[model samples]
Target: MTDPNAPVTVTPADDMPASSAKAVQALALKHLYIAWVRFQRRPESMRSFIGYDLLYFPPPYAAKWAKPFGYIRQAASTIAAIRRHKPDVLWFQSPPTFFAHLLVAYRALGGRRLKVVADCHNMGLDPDVPGNFWMKIPGTIPALNSFDVVIAHNAAVGAKAAGLGVRSDRLLVLETRPAPLPVDETAGDPVPQVILVPCSYHDDEPIEMLMEVAARVPDATFKLTGNLARAQSKNYPARAPANVQFTGYLSAEAYTHLLTNCSLVIGLTTGEGIQLSGANEAVGAGRPMVLSDTQLLRSLFGDAALFAANETAPMAAAVQDALSRQGELRQASRTLKDKRERRWRLQAEACLERLVP
Candidate 1:
């Protein structure tokens, strides 16, 4: 219905419909301006048309042997980039880490006018976790308090933030949204695989539980993907489970192939963090999931996912249940996919309207 060569029309803030709020307009303008600045600095970064100018600061060191200064340098570069871009809202993907503190310092110095939003990806409640130590300390708690808004991925995380003395009103729960599943018409041969396990080197992830489950279900084949650390990959539990097969990290195309063909996805992590991105991707691809029953996980997936209590025998039982009821779970997975997509779109729209109006 439209001409391909015609210029795209964007309504001006003043001329926008009355339904749009002034706050939304201001927010949108701020983000657009920031996006423009980012484009000027590195044009390639603008490929994704998401409204906010997101600057992700990856952790500094992978191993204990690495010097701390290298991480500090990376943090400094991130801060410098933010300063140059001068975004209206500075959204930190996962705060309470060392790199996040660097960002906090940058915001404190001269970026006071910036509307800072700290997006908490993990539950910082447990004292044993590395980030929790900083979160618990008196000085560190107030440091995080400076942000205008604290965005929690799930209700459990929001509660944790509140317990840490974060203002209840400022804590917004924004769950992670799965990317649209790729359509593959080829329809590869079905392997009848019951479980998919995506593993990383992180200790918090319940890899041991997965191994236990794989051992328990002799008839089921477990496909493990994602890069494992040298030690983890080398010494992976091999003797007990002939059904377990490690395929390392798959390319997007290959991963999609597996997702399209797999019966169920499973993860057993102890940390109160919400389901990892892979879990959302699996659900989006219409794969039933058996995840840990942490507060964050329960909040995000609700009853849509089969949950195990405290990362042990119950987790294996949940996985078995998902495997047994694959048909119903598959239908539930599709419903969840639809619900999550709608929620994500609404949240994104709200965020965009707030920034761009």
Candidate 2:
């Protein structure tokens, strides 16, 4: 007889039917590759033992290029992995529109013991975005509800998901916090007059407005760096203003180097609820920041960074403000670094509690 208080073990049964092997294994499906790196850095409780799918599926970069059958092939392999390994829990990342349909169908209809989870990164993803036909299916919402849990980055984002008919009880908020700085507090002095603008350029970001702001502040060069900037290079309004430069997607070393050495960092966005990833990198590097004015950014940054309305004029003013008050902004960066050090681990722990069973 199985002891209720005893430990559980998964013994390989190769000779057993393939289906039966899954009955013994406890795994975590990592189809949402982007979430893997974040979760990997968390307390081991949130760590998953297994992973599947491409290791490099950054949004719009690969997903946008993938043909329908390509997605089908990707989903097929992931499903096969889950059915074979039969993970105790499967965690998916943002835009949760991928592979979830099949898994929900299988879990609802099949007697699989898997408990599925979808973690939303608040990259300003909306299931209702037009032309995203997959999200419109009648079954999609129901399928998402069928998952054991849906972890949102914040309450506002959770509300967005809930509006799509998902139960509030199924949606949990895991506040996103800044990552720890890569360098020590006493690293080399920052470069003078170089403002680094880090962006993923998710839809609705004011890239052109930033360029205009760059044009207005020709004295301080605005370095736009990321995949989004590179992807939109062909459509850039004009030869970038004399002071604006795009550095393409950066290597970690390059990104860290730039973030650590910049005079200021700019992370502008349109989502009122979304937290920008660049904000975390800025706080970690102890660099002053200029973020678009939004309740979410304001709460996270408090007095640590400058805020600007999405308008070109206000954004330009914010940059000029940061430039004028470099001393105060530098102090704010120190304060933010301290706060991030104190709060990030706690925040990460809390998020994991909701994420893992």
- For all candidates in order, the CA lDDT equals 0.58, 0.61
TM-scores, all candidates, are 0.72, 0.73
Number of clashes in every candidate structure? 7, 1
Candidate 1 lDDT over 1-357, as tens digits, reads 332112222233322223335444544443422111111111111113234444434335557577466566556666566666766766554434444466566656765467666656563433444334545544544655665656666666667667877776566666667545653334432456556776654667666667787777777888887654542655774543788877875654676677767878876566765457667766667777888777767766764788787545777678778777877777777788788866764554444443332
Candidate 1 C-alpha RMSD relative to the actual structure:
7.4
RMSD in angstroms between candidate 2 and the native structure over all alpha carbons: 9.5
lDDT of 2 by residue, 1-357 (tens): 322112123222212212322322322222222232211222111222122222322232245556565556555555565565555566666444655666766666764665666666553235543233546545666766777667676667678878877777677665544544454556443545899987655465778788889889988878887665444754663556888877776665676788778888898877677677678777766777899999978988876999989999999998988888766776777787777645544543443344344
- Model 1 TM-score is 0.72
